[model samples]
Target: MSDQPAAAEPGRLTTREAAGRLGVKPETVYAYVSRGQLSSRRAPGGRGSTFDAAEVEALAARGARREPPLSGSDLAFRTGVTLIDPDAGHYYFRGVDATELAGRYGYEEVAEWLWTGTLRPGVRFTAPPEALEAGRRAAGALPVHSTAMDRLRAAAVAASAADPLRFDLSPDAVLRTARALIPALVGSLPAEGARDADADRLAQRLWRRLTAHEPDEGSLAVLEAALVLLIDHDLAASTLATRVAASARAHPYAVVSAGLGALEGPLHGAASGLAHRMLAEVLERGGAAPVVADHLRSGRRVPGLGHRLYRGEDPRAGALFALLDRVPAAGPALAAARDVVATTARHTDLYANVDLALAVLSVASGMRAEAGEALFAVARTAGWIAHALEEYAERPLRLRPRGQYTGPQPAQPLP
Candidate 1:
């Protein structure tokens, strides 16, 4: 909070020198100070701020870990949860490779791994019959024109209100609640008479609810892989919201509700549907070139083409796309996706991301238009739980960040 500049000393670097060390401009240097990541001091005689040389170097080292650096105005803060290495175009869940886990295990198995650091292969999520019935009633209470996510959100509130033990914040209790919540949310949607037809596996259960289509092996694989791949990433906006709620010791149900609320935003989980529409444009035009040119001319980004953390490639996209090959139904959409990615790569470094892959698979499988976003929300529920668990172990409310208070100055003392 010190505005006066630090006195020059052997161990201190001026603002300009610190900026050079971080490979950013002075404004960016100030941004770092504002985040409290780097300590700044008043310059002797009010010249300007200077920073501790060691602190600046340490931040530089952390920046190197992210390679090209995280975009979207987020600070390069550290977390013990997920490591998204853009340099290698890969991410890890608590030090283990995510793509490998997604390929080898179902979402249930991988989600358990993220939550407890051990994969529980045969473990499955199931809700009590009464709880599921309650969830369905809550979802049914929503107004017409409700999206699937809306139903999920409503179901969460109902589940929380009905549980007498919802206040428990212990790790074991949280995991127990999560175990019940995932299945409850899945079961709450409108179903085709046989609600439990594919009840043994989460993906097939969701497939029936999403499109009421009987399970196809290839399509099931695509949905399962999409779920596992989206289990966790770095602190996305939704995940951050979940953690902030957890920091206040909100119940597991409330924590997930916080995350799903953020996920509903068009810029986040809903983004996959937009990505699908963009590629549909390429199909209509018979080429990626014109679509790309038109999007650029309009000053809007070509959706789902790139990501901030993984500038080279999104590993989840690669993992999910691999499964699409066996899904012969997705053939045309896959072909169009390839054309768009290839064309975008040729023109700019922007590459296809997981959202683009999800959209393509959704289109190919003949699912509802909002199917991809639903899958994203379901998968990310695991991540929100993991983040909430981590936050629970920290001091309560530690996530409360200070504001710079640039609004109106102190109110006049008149009256």
Candidate 2:
């Protein structure tokens, strides 16, 4: 036989050839493998990886078919509820500054205003006794190791089953459901301390479930502000899920359930828990430098330091940090959080986001790491309902988008 080596397989491409076909660096091709977006195999003699030519072509085609950047006129919906001004580093609910509303009013009052466009001073939300009982029972029945988010999901479903009028999608009915559901979601959690009086504000009631310590007025204020600040931001992932449910005319409870389902991932609602863990590590190590360094070394983002919509510090974080400054217990956690920001600032321009502020509250108050996630879910319930109401008025299923099929041809033979 001739000494010459065999030619490459007809259907395979080397790493460089694959990268060239995909119009990206060989490193990005490796990244695609790491992300499970593409597959590679060892080349003959184990010199380097080879990719299937057909797979590379398909990926390149998909990239070429990617849509252009969305404009205001493309897939935009009219909303009167919330507006975010990224340039100004501010957000508004009903055209009024969100921070102003959060500072001036309670969570219930702000929620009512967002729902009805009218504010009633001292407005309160109370769960019906029966609904609260059902929610608690369902939440309590979960496995012992179940997360707080799991209990919330269970409670939402139980609450829906208990509400016979849940199918009523009328505006008045949805408004009533919104009020009762928010409180029921809060009340379902097992209390860590003495049960709060029913007449207590929602924040006060929620405090008992989060920690055994009695809440001072300052800490309570911080919690209340956090609730109001988190009430809505603009079509967040969960809110969009809620809107899609509402567009299909699902009941308010189901809409909320959809939102809760979408809130489970770390990148969204559970982000605060990550921040809490990071801050706790910082406090334990007696400094932020080591913790930050470890995060960078491990290729993990230091959570709670950035917001896509804001150019500076998250306004919600600013509001909560201001209130936290007044509570003596928050001093150490707040300092640690500040240390994290300072330490990270040396490398990146990222500023503290609301997740960091929530972490400070949870750590200082001796609440579980999951406390911030619970606070986010309960507060954002109001926003979900508001979006539901908006979607209920729109043309049905307007949020649906057609998928572009990119798989093998339909006539392919069975394997």
CA lDDT of 201 in candidate 1?
Answer: 77
Query: TM-score for all predictions?
Result: 0.78, 0.82
RMSD of 1: 14.4
Q: lDDT by residue for model 2 over 208-309, one digit each (tens)?
A: 989999889999999999999999989899998998898899999999999999999899999999999999999999999999999999999999999989
Off by over 4 Å in 2: 1-74
Residue range 140-180, candidate 1, lDDT tens digits: 99898998999999999888877889998755567778888
Counting only residues 3 or more apart in sequence or on different chains, how many pairs clash (N, Cα, C under 3 Å) in candidate 1? Answer: 6
Q: Go through the candidates in order and give each one's C-alpha lDDT.
A: 0.78, 0.86
Residue 389 of model 2: what lDDT? Answer: 75
What pairs collide in candidate 2? none
